[model samples]
Target: MALALNDKVLTEVYGPSTGTALRIKQVAMVVLGIAVLAIAAKIKVPVPGSPVAMNMGTFAVLTIGAAYGPRLGLTTILGYMIVGMLGFDIFQSSTADLNGINYMMGSTGGYLVGYVLATLALGFAARAGWDRSMGKMALAMLLGNVIIYLPGVAWLGVLYGFDQPILQWGLTPFLIGDALKLALAALLLPAIWKLVGDARK
Candidate 1:
């Protein structure tokens, strides 16, 4: 009975083969996922002069990573970047250009790259059979957020002398907001996973 139950679970988790139809569906889903992520980028919390502002994109990134697994998550973020580069006007404040490149290369660039890494890391964690519990999801998001900041701060130090006062604009104000965003991602991602699970069921 236990073996039979396990088989049933596996079958449910990994759907039966549908060949081309499945491929089409996957493509459609990826396109839709990109659109959703674009919308997420549009929803921003403005911060003055600081390129780092809070946005729902991270939550969408977490959701995409969990739902589509690592490769798709990475692809989706790449898609987002491409869209921005093409002047989609989806990025919160700046449109894609040389200035955009500068912004991407600036202190926030690390965080941007981190978004890709975070998605891949979190998606891989999920694929490795991490429990879809809220706690685990929160921890994953938290770690991902932190991973990006390392590069962000390092770049900031390189761009603007590290010896410069830390308070005026060196990761302090952003900390509270980032934590809040992480908390928001933690709260939302699990609910989204559950909904996706229910749809699969």
Candidate 2:
């Protein structure tokens, strides 16, 4: 069956049930999630024909969303953005010298917004047990990417004029990278579920 009707998520499977311990776990998870997002953002590789580099940030974002579920996922993502807004070098294109509000309002702003949307999408999907199977998880990840790309491409078109090759600039270059990340997430999530299952046996 799906999720066993308990509403349990990956994090909750191994986490405390309630009380101060649960609160502490959630807060600590948010902190760790922020750290993961920051590290992923910085680990960028230049795309050969694209202005934007391919980064692991999306992968981390989707994984976090699936693992943490909607509420914690949203909290973690918001916290990450808050950290970036506070002038931290924790976004894909931000740095110590060129961070904060102005930087967030730049070209990549739409994708940042998309991260929140995709997280909720994936989180809800995971809570519904989509993350339990490889095929379903892959589909869920694909949906999340589409959610991310729509706003991202739209923002690029708006920011740089629709006359510009917005799809070429913001979409196509990352398709290959995103595909790889999607496959990784698909495989990784199901595999983790297996581990979780096996651990209890």
Candidate 3:
């Protein structure tokens, strides 16, 4: 069995560089994380027969959560949301007309909210040693991915209707994509850790 690595990927990758350098690195990581989330959100695929699109935002969320610890991960996600709310086209569901607070109150707002929860959930798990091995990382990613749909489906259902069809439209269509993303993230983290550890030695 592999021993648990440190929860924060930056700290692990860069060695124990201290003081202002570490703080700068952490701040840069948070900003980069937000940029990553935005980039992932932009990779949108229109799902046929559903209003909800398949996007890699959750995948990025999982990756960032696993890399950053809870506090930093949560802060990073919140920063992403704030950026979106401030009229940036950083959100996956961003529209030409509705870019600011309007988008938040729009249909995809709940999933937007769920992003924070997913980050916190996965962040906590990563910090607690779930990010070390493939099996545990996969489980943590799966849980994190699933929780995103709670608010997603709820908000979607409320905006549309409280019916099975609506639920299916909001969630069922994305399960396969989410599973693939989860598996990718699970494998990706371990691979990154292995590569980084080897490089440092």
- The list of candidate 1 runs beyond 4 A from truth reads 1-17, 96-103, 165-170, 189-201
Q: C-alpha displacement of 101 in model 2, angstroms? A: 0.8
Distance from true position, residue 122, model 2, in Å? 0.6
Candidate ranking (lDDT, best to worst): 2, 3, 1
How does each model score on TM-score? Answer: 0.74, 0.94, 0.89
Rank candidates, TM-score, best first. Answer: 2, 3, 1
lDDT of 3 by residue, 91-128 (tens): 88787787989988777788888889999988778776
Tens-digit per-residue lDDT, 1-201, candidate 1: 221111111112444347886667656666887899778877877666564666677677766776666766677778777776665666555664543555466555666676788778767756643325678767877777676666666667777778964334536666776677777766665665565575434
Off by over 4 Å in 2: 1-6, 198-201
- Please identify model 3 stretches exceeding 4 Å from their true place: 1-12, 15-17, 198-201
CA shift of 8, model 2, Å = 1.3
Whole-model Cα lDDT of every candidate shown, in order: 0.64, 0.89, 0.82
Pairs with backbone N, CA or C atoms under 3 Å apart (clashes), candidate 3: none
Q: All predictions: root-mean-square deviation over Cα? A: 5.3, 2.3, 3.1
